[model samples]
Target: MTTKINRHLTWQRMCACMATCAMAIVVACPIAGFASVQTASADDTANTVSTIIVRDGMLSRYTQLGGAQGILRQPLENEHPTANGGAEQRFQGGTLFWNPSLRGSYLVRDGMLSRYTQLGGPAGRLGLPCADELAVPGGASQVFQGGTLFWNPSLRGAYLVRDGMLSKYAAARYEQGPYGLPVSDEYAWNGGARQDFQYGSMFWNVSDWWKYSSQGPYPNLAGVSNLNVAVSIASQRVYIRDGERVLYTMITSTGINDWTPRGTYRINGRGPSFYNRNEAMGARNWVRFIGNFLFHSVPIDSSGNYIVSEAWKLGQPASHGCIRLTVADSQWFYNAIPDGTLVSIW
Candidate 1:
């Protein structure tokens, strides 16, 4: 017990000595060194005096943005002339990109900055930022990289638009077109490039997007291939597609006992036709595909009574080899589908 007490006293004396030495060093150090150390502290939010200088419009704009206490914090770099004869100033959390074309410098941050880096900043296609993020119809946007990164505070991120797609979006009055602002970057699709937008997607398979050409339902179809129909026996659902874009989807039932042949076919004809072994007028609404595979309604007896057991088996394979759809869906398919809609099963 005496040894432990002595050891504790010795440790306390050592700690006091260490603290005194630290205080002595601080007292001996020059004031400039201490200021330098404080400037580089971990709290980037610290509002230390910055020696960085700004002038003219840059200074005016910096003050307007609330100087040191504002969102921009402190200026990290000096203002420099851009290739477009404009000026730019980088801040702690955002950047002020200004061109003679604008009233004041626009601030950019968040998803806008990340996308700017990805698009290669000023060195890439989008040259200097002509404007800061400003309000538009649905949300806000900033013009950069010769395009715009649109942001909505309520939405998670911004959408991108530039080049031909931007032209289309503008032509459609900005989000007024079938293809809205691009939610995704351009990617390889169907031997060409494609981008997704808010309202719908656009395809740039090196095709004439501005041609106002009509393919399927789009007066401005932008994809490489027309999205078609697909039926999965396993999941028992139907999908109407335009490339990867699913126009419509519905739950369906397929054949049981290997009766549903798995192959791709088209809508060769429509109904007022017989449904399987039920005979002509056997199905009130139906369509035929493959040799015998059909998209038909729930079974109706000769007196038009709903077959209860067959109705209960709607999502399961109950038909001989036919695909079953609800009555309204079957009726719509029979009445609406043109003669040559594509159909595939597996």
Candidate 2:
């Protein structure tokens, strides 16, 4: 009886020892067996996990954003080091960028991503994306460390604005301001840079920046029976009309004290340029609506130099007897209006 009891006690001790040894093995390498389990359970969002873990890196963000079920989809490649001690990784849905200076990762995908890559990716002018893509008034945009990427249907793809041009755009209210979304990326022009927007193009040089309204070419107003020009002396504006339908409006400067005749007339002869030595001023692209009265550009000197002081008087009564327009608008008028077009001054 005593021998049998001692053998039973020894068997119990061996079982307890085996159980402790198994526990020690598991504690020593806690993550060793987790990959397979996570892979099998990845379909479930709550249970989805990243097999690879890196502090403040792509893998950690992937798991946090819902792993396989997240918008990032599945990991296509392992996390890799980037320039400046940063890290990045590619996934099925998009690429993840992890900046050491920033807390987490940013995702850039679809058209925005393609444009970013074209602009030089992380090594390019745009650098790494600082934030995810965001919806704007007309289209979508994503912020990068160096600049912002813009995408819309009208743009055909994505474009970016950076540096001084970007500052000018922001001041102008971005896409919501006078200029709409960027239609073209910044490009070298002369010794400076230029970027085109929906309504205008912004130019930047070493010292200053300026904008030009891109009215483009005049539309074909053919076969319209009631095409006419209405000049408003009170509002300092010229309204182009097809019957009562207002097709376009242009800013103009007329004579002070109503020197411009307020009577019905017809557009007659046209000339490229004229200089009045008596007035010591000149103008270009004149379309004569009446004798000694015409539609012409803002006053220039006899040497064909723009009179800055006179040009500044646009949108008010500043001309002597002719209707003064911007050089661009006057040129457009000279090209678009033909002989026998009706003109009414009021």
- Considering every candidate listed, which one attains the maximal TM-score? 2
TM per candidate? 0.45, 0.59
lDDT of 1 by residue, 1-346 (tens): 1121111222223222211221121111111222212233344432233344555676667668886568886557777776666677787778777767664676777778876767666666676676767777667778764887887455657766778767756765675433434556666655665666554345565442211111123222234267467887775666667766766554466877968888878887666646334442245567878666678776777666656556556546777788876565666566665557777787
Query: Candidate 2 — which pairs collide?
Result: none
**Candidate 2 per-residue C-alpha lDDT over 1-346 given as tens digits, one digit per residue, 9 for 90 to 100:** 1121111222223222221231121111112223222222324332232243233356567667785568876455567877656678887688899876776698889999888888778888878778889999999889888998889776579989889999988987788765668888888875798887664566787222211213334456887679899898876777678987756666678998889999999999999999999999989889999998999988889789888788767667988879988777788889888888889898
Model 1's number of clashes is: 7
RMSD in Å for all candidates = 18.0, 12.8
- In Å, residue 6's CA in model 1 sits off its true spot by 31
lDDT of each: 0.60, 0.73
Worst 10-residue lDDT window, candidate 2:
22-31
* TM-score, candidate number 1: 0.45
Once model 2 is optimally superposed onto the true structure by TM-score, how far is the C-alpha of residue 88 displaced, in angstroms? 1.2
